[model samples]
Target chain A: MRKLSRSSGDVGKKITETIEAVSEAIEDTLVVSRKFARQDEETLGNAERIIDSVLRRFSRAASGLTESEELLRTENNAINYEISDVFVALQFQDRVSQILALVCDDLNKLEQHLNELKSQQADEGSSRSVNVEQWLEELSKTYTMEEQLTAHDGTKAEIKTDQPGITFF
Target chain B: MAKTILFVEDSASVRQVMNSTLTREGYDVILACDGQDALTRLDGSKIYLIISDVNMPNMDGLTFVKSAKQMPAYKSTPIIMLTTETQEVKMNEGKAADVKAWIVKPFQPAQLLAADSQLIQA
Candidate 1:
């Protein structure tokens, strides 16, 4: 199992290349230090081929790392777009909350209006000066926003629940 | 240079989420809980844009836009009203107040960003 990190993509190539380069440098230094040692051309040639093969593999591994980084970035962008969409959708909570709050506001106003009606009747010693239509008109004043007005509009027209934008004039 | 956006919303949770999204995109965000609070926030800073909610405790969105336009510094600033109200009368009032954009609630980020990019300069 490989744990992916921001820099992990470069780790494999760097580690392999660094180890190979150091080993070659150390071997060449050893050869140079042994001044009186017998020169083995065949052994040295074999060592060169082996190092070349390792270096080629390291290069391929590095290329693979670049490919992996590209893939990871593509996937990340896709998830981010989805997350962005989700965040956008989540704003419905605010919309619904606003509507409910207005509904509650209407209810509170209605209750107050009813209480005033009862008080007027009680003060008059009978139900005489209580005009329900006038109270209804006053109730409409409590409703300010369009949604509240729409709810009060008695008609067959369906209320537009979707939020529409007006960008141009 | 990062642009500063004033977001006037009553819902704290919505503000937090929107703040995260806008700030992640390198925009400096100033928050206001209502229209009155939003009024206090407009202290002569060079605000790039404003995103406001319609229904609030102290003052509603249309009134806020009108009040914001009264401030000489923010009269022509790009204002986007974000709310659930979809009435033509209210929108007309907003237009009169120099609000160029009106975004409905539950709006997409791309929609908002597009409006912002179109309105806000570099």
Candidate 2:
């Protein structure tokens, strides 16, 4: 099949459109995620702290009251169940944080894709014409382009490839 | 001294390029990664304008604008949303959030810098 080429200008506009859409989606996710982070970050951590406080308070109160040993043991057992409940809540919090991380990762990918589009536009602008489908196909074959760095502890050190592969959609 | 402009973007590379270019143009440059972080750094700092990326981790640009607008100190601040997309809905959302301008990404550096100067001088 003959490859159809797009002018640098046209490709620039198309890439801009795609990047804007992805950026907006990321913004939407960011809105929700920020709210979650603000409201939820210390939620589980605070719950655990509160549980400890409650147990301490119960122990102090039981010591003051002239209750039977069995009664005090029953109160302790109830508090243990409550502590278990707090653990369950903490697990939920952890899961929610994980989901937010996934959202952040997707948004980061979108941002990177936008950067690639711009770079491609610049490269095309420099060259005057580019095949969009071929470019995208090549991008699809590669994984994500993440932030990376390489440095040797000493001079004349051999270079090694430590770059992660892109996970294309 | 040139008017100061603050840029809040998450990407390290973008931040570096923007800082270098903006500083070269005689503008005082301050940088932050996200909306909340920007707010933290804004105290005692005189910023004539703000340019922000839409999708950030701790705080998005629009929501940032919404919160910033509510602050009496920054009520008149001219906030611009920089993005790679040009969706109408997103623009409208930004408008409602009181963002002063929306710039689609891959912008020409000349045009972006020119716009910044204009906004700062105005």
Candidate 3:
């Protein structure tokens, strides 16, 4: 029998650090994403409001301007439409933030599961999987995300949430 | 009276988007954060449809759909899974739960609206 080197590092500390790191990352993401998202939303909303006000104010002022000056109105209208398009495009961030939030949730669950695995590892050499197979089955029944299934697919861990397809069950 | 749809999703932005869109389309929307919350929202209200995210905190979509189907009113009320998953195992699990439709996420509002209309009309 080949004897592997006995590792002296504290496994408990490593697991604790990993979980803490994940929690910290999640908190940081939540704080930063929310802050930036709020700023982005305000910027977009103000742009729309400014556009609306400019359009209303300019259309009235345009009545008194020369034909050449009225060309600026057309250009302003185009600019406002472009600004609106940018606002719509920024909505993609909402979708991305939603996905990132879900990732944090998974990290939280992973920490819990890791803690459970560590506890089982310390209790003799009994296989936790063997003892908890039934529990695992029921545990999956409580799944709440498509990512959970994608993670277990054993193929490419591709998370294609943007694709639109429907199947009847 | 407008038709009521129960939407179970954990994200506030997603819920807001869906609620606004559906409300604009003349439907009343009730919301829940997850499957367990969805069960509580049931509250014997007349719901025309149930749309849910597959992965959620507290309870998952598959189990919720299965549990909801156990009820008489919900058995006939169609359910659509709005998720990012395309795995056969997940599809099978949803099928077992009696989910009527599986619409992958990042979907167009029209796509789901069309499905909702078709199912409701049927």
The per-prediction CA RMSD against the true structure, in angstroms, equals 19.9, 44.6, 41.2
* Worst 10 contiguous positions by lDDT, candidate 3 chain B: B103-112
lDDT of 3 by residue, B1-122 (tens): 89999999886767877787789789999999999999998877689999998877799888899888888878889989987565778888887787889987656666778989988887
lDDT by residue (tens digit), candidate 1, A15-57 = 9999999999999988886743445666788799999999999
Candidate 2, A3-62: lDDT as tens digits: 334576678899999999999999999999999997786897899899999999999888
For candidate 3, write residues A71-156 as lDDT tens digits.
Answer: 88889777656643443343344445655675677568767877887788888666554345654555456454455545543455
Q: Give stretches of model 3 more than 4 Å off.
A: A1-164
Q: Which CAPRI level is candidate 1?
A: acceptable
The superposed Cα distance between candidate 3 and the true structure at residue B47, in angstroms, equals: 1.0
lDDT assessment of candidate 1: 0.78
Ranking by lDDT: 1, 3, 2
Q: What is the TM-score of each predicted model, taking all chains together? A: 0.68, 0.42, 0.51
Chain A TM-score for predicted structure 2: 0.34
Q: How would you encode candidate 2's per-residue C-alpha lDDT over B1-122 as one tens digit per residue?
A: 78788898876656766787788779888899998998887675567888887767899877777877777777777777776334567778877777767765444455466677666666
DockQ of 1: 0.41
